[model samples]
Target: MSVRQLLYLAPIAAVLLASSSVVNGQDGVAEELVVLTDLAGLGRDENSVTYFKASNAGAYERFGESIALSADGTTLAVGAIFEDSSATGVGGDQADFSAPNAGAVYIFTRTGSNWSQQAYIKASNTGASDRFGLSVALSHDGDTLAVGALGEDSAATGINGDQHDNSIDNAGAAYIFTRENRTWSQQAYIKASNTGRIEEGDQFGYDVVLNGNGDTLAVSAISEDSAATGVGGEQDDDSAAEIGAVYVYSRDGADWSQQAYLKPRSFSTEMLIGGILFGFAIGMDESGNTLAISGFNEETNRGSIYVFERAGSDWFEQARLVASNPEIGDGLGSAIAVSADGNTIAAGAFDEDSALVGIVPSDQGIDDQRTDDAIGAAYVFVRRGDTWSQQAFIKPTNTQVNQHFGWTLALSLDGDTLAVGAHFENGGSTGINGDQRDTSAQDAGAAYVYSRSGTTWTPRAYVKASNTFARAEFGSSLALNDDGTVLAVGAPREADGAAGINGNQAADSAAESGAVYIY
Candidate 1:
C-alpha cells in the first residue's frame, strides 16, 4: 500500500489537488490561490498616488488617505484625511513640518463598475497637526466606519503637541461614523476614561475593527498606561519599549462605552516587569464581543497571542497562546487575524526557526540549509468544547530557514482554509536552486495556502505574484476577506513595474520602499 501525495501549485493561485481523492480514491479536484496588488491597475494622482486593493480597495499617499467599500461589494464608503487649508495648508515650503493633519469621511455609491466621488467630509473642527483620518476600518456589512486620530488632543490629555516633549500624556482617540439614508455622520468618539495623563500618550485607538452590528469594538494602544490592566511595560532605555494594551467597548442603544480592558495572563514579579501583555494588534467578532489581540513583544524579540470571550454581554480573558514550541527567540503571534465568530485564529511568527530541508546532493539540485535561520511560520487554533486547541501548524512543506513562517496569517470564517506567508523564501529563482542557504535572491518573499480535511490538513498551493520582483519581501503584511476568496499581501520594498515587480531583480541594497499585493 502506498500513500498518495498531494500536489501543490504556485502560490499566486494556491490551487491543490490530491493525486487521488481520498473520498472517491480516483477523482481529482482543482484548488485555488489568487493574488491581488494595487500596483497593477491604479490611476496615479497627486493626492492618492499609491492605491491599494484590499478586500474593498484602499488608497493612501502623501497628500491624503482614503478607504471605502460598498456594503454589497459594488459600492464604496470612502474617507480621506488631509490638511484643511482654512486651518493649515501645504505652506510655501514643501519640507515645512508646521502643517496640520485634518481630514473627513465620504460615502460613495457605486453602480455596475463605475464609481464617482460621492461626499467630502471635512473634520468638524479641523486644526493644525490633526491627522483625523489616520486609519479606517469597516464593518462586515460595510455600513459603519471607525476612524482613528492618534494626534487628537480633544480630551486634553497632559501630553502637549510638542514633537520634542517626552511626556506620555497624549491618549489617542477614534470616531464612529454610520450610514443612514445614504448619508454618513459621526456616531461616537472613543477615548479611555480619564483621557488625560502622562500615561495617555500610549497612542490608544491607533487601530480598530468592528463587528457586523458595530456595537462591540476593539481598539489597540501599543502604548497606553502600563500601570493599568491589559497594558505591557518595558525595561529601561533600550528603546524596546512595551507600553501596550487594548480596550473593548460596547454599544447600547446609541451610547457606546468601554466594557473591558484586555491584557495577557502572566506570572510576573513586578507590574513594570514588561514580561507579558504588550498589545499591538486587535480584531473583533460581529457583535464586537469576542476579541483577539497580539503582543508583538511579549518576550525579548518574541511575541504572544491572547483571546477573550464575552459571556452574554460581559467580556473576560479567555485563553493565551504562546507558540507551542517555546523557543526563547521565536516571536510567535507577532501579527494576528481572527474570524468574525472568533472561533478561528491565525497568527504570524516572522522569526520562526525551521529545518524543513536538511541536505541534498549537488547534481540533484536540492540545496542544503534551505530551511535555516528564522524563516517565518503560522499556527491555527480552533475552539472545541470549553477549550481551544491547535487545529493545524502549517509552514510550506518545502520551506527554507529564515523564510520567516508567520510574516502574516489569515483564516476564513469557517476555518477551512488558511494562508501563511514566508516573506524570505527563495522561490526557485536563484541558480543556487532550492538551497535554504541560497540568499542569492536575498529577501524575496512568498505566501502559502492550506486547507483542512476533517482532522487532517494539507498544503494546497504555493504562490507569489508572477511579476514579483526579487528581494521584494511580499509577505510582510497580509489580509484575507471573510470567505478566503481575496487576499492582500504587502511587499512594501518591491519596485513599481511588471518585470521587476516582486523579487525579480536584486534590491539596491536591503533598504527599499513597500508595496501591497492583492489576490
Candidate 2:
C-alpha cells in the first residue's frame, strides 16, 4: 500500500488541552480568553498562532497528528507521522524525500514570546514506513524524548539493539534521546522484552511516556498477547491472543531496564478481532509512582482503565475503573488524562448517550434509548487513600448528537482545569464563546475548557478555529502545558497549505496537509 493509504490505518489517539481564559470562583464569572490565529511576531501575552508544513507543501504530511509540551511551556514537540523526509537525525536536510512516511518531529523553543525551530529529529536508522514520529513524549525538563514508530518492523528485543533488522513487519520500536547543552543524541532503542517471538502486529511502542525526572518510562504494546496475568508471568503463551500489555522501564544512571510487565486483570475476549482492544491511552504522574492505562474496546467495547501504583521497584494493580452506567459501545477509555500527582483522572466515553447535563447522578441506571448517541461524556475520578471514586460527569452545555465530545482530553497539572475535544462538533462558531446555534460548518470541531474550584467543576470557555471550515477536525489532538497556560490544537485535515507561522489560510489550498494552532 502507498504511504498515504497506510497512514489511514493507524488508530486515532487523544490529546491534552491548554486555555486562554480564567474563571473567577465567585458567581461563575469567566474572563475573556484571547484567541490568536497566527503566531508570527507575537509577544508573551498574545493569543495564539497556527503552524503548518514549513519545508514542503501538498505532501499529506499530517504535521499536528501528535504533540507534546515541556512542563514550563517554553518548549514544544510536534509530530508529523506522514512526513516523507529521509533526514537521519537532528539538523539534517529536511527537504530529502528519499524515504516515504519515515516521519519527523519538530522542536520549538520559546524565549520571551518568540518561538523558533530548535531541532528536526528522526530515527537514527530511518527507513521507509518507519513512521518514527507516530507518537512523541518529552520529559518535564524538556531534556529527554521518547519517540514511537508503530510501523517500525525491527525484531530486536532490548535497548539499543539493531534497528536495521526489519524481519518482523510492524513489530514496532521506540527511540530515546537526551539533550545536553542543547544537542540531542540517541540514548536507547526499546522494544518489548517478553514478546517471546517477533510478531508482525505487536506495535510495541504505540504510546510512550516519561516521568518528570526522565528516569522512569512506560510504553504500551497494545497488540502484545500472552497469557501473562501480571509481572513476569507466562509471556510465551499466544493463546491469550492480543490481550495487550504495558511495560515499565527504569533508568539507573545512564542505563535502562525493564522493571515490570502489566496486563489487565481479565483478558479481553475482543482479541479475536485483532485491533480494537489495544491500549489506546496511558497517563502517569510526574514521579512515575502511579500509572493509568485505558483499553478502548475492553469488555465488549464498554471500555475500561486500569490503575497501578508503584511499591518500591515493583508495581501492583490498585483499581479498575469503568463508567458508572456502563453501556455497550460507549468507548469509555478512548481518551484519558491524569493529574501531575496521579490522584485525579479524566476518561472520555465519546459514544456515551445521556441528555442530562453536568455531573450525572452516580447511581443512575443505564438508559438504552440512545437519545444522545455520540454526544459523548467524560468522567472524573479522584483518589482518596487507596480508593478512587467518581467525582464528576461532564458534558457540553449545548449537547448535540454526534458531536463526539471527549474524543480527546487534557488536564492541568494540579487537576483544576480540563479540556475536551469534540472533533465532529458541527458548530460554525469561531474563537471562544461564539454562537453554537449555527450548524453551517459540519465536522468543523470545537473544544471546551472547564475549571474546578474545590469539588465543583464549571464550564469556562468554548474554543474553535479562526478559519472554521467543514471537515477540518480542529480538535483531533491537543497538548497542554503544566499550568494549562498554553494549548496546542491540531486540525490534520485542514485545507490551508500555509507553511510556518501565520501564512495566508487560503481556501482549499492544502487539503489534508494539516495545521497546528497554539493558544
Q: What's model 1's TM-score?
A: 0.66
Residues 1-519 of candidate 1 have per-residue lDDT tens digits of 000010000011111111111121111212222222232132111122222221111122111132323223433433334433323211122223233444444444434433444444443434454555544566666667776655555653222222223333345667777777666666776765534455435456556667766777777766554444433223112222244567667778777877666665553443245533355556665556668887665665456777877877666678887666545456666557676677777776666664432111111211212222675556677777658886655555554656766655656566666767676776644111122233355566766666666866655445554334566665654544555544445554455422211222332332333344333
**Backbone clashes under 3 angstroms, per model:** 58, 2
Query: Can you tell me which runs of candidate 2 are displaced by over 4 Å?
Result: 1-57, 195-199, 268-278, 357-359, 363-365, 368-372
Residue-by-residue lDDT tens digits, candidate 2, 1-519: 221232232222222233343332211123354433222233222234444444454547777667777888777777777788787878888888888888888777778866677788988888888878777788988999988887788778878777788888778788888888888888888988863355545777777778888899988877676766756677767665556778889989889999988876655445444434446778888889999888777766678888988989988889989888878778787678899999999988878876554445555435522744788888899999989998887876556778878777877789988888888888887666667667789888877777788997767667777677798787877777787666677776777777676677655777776776666
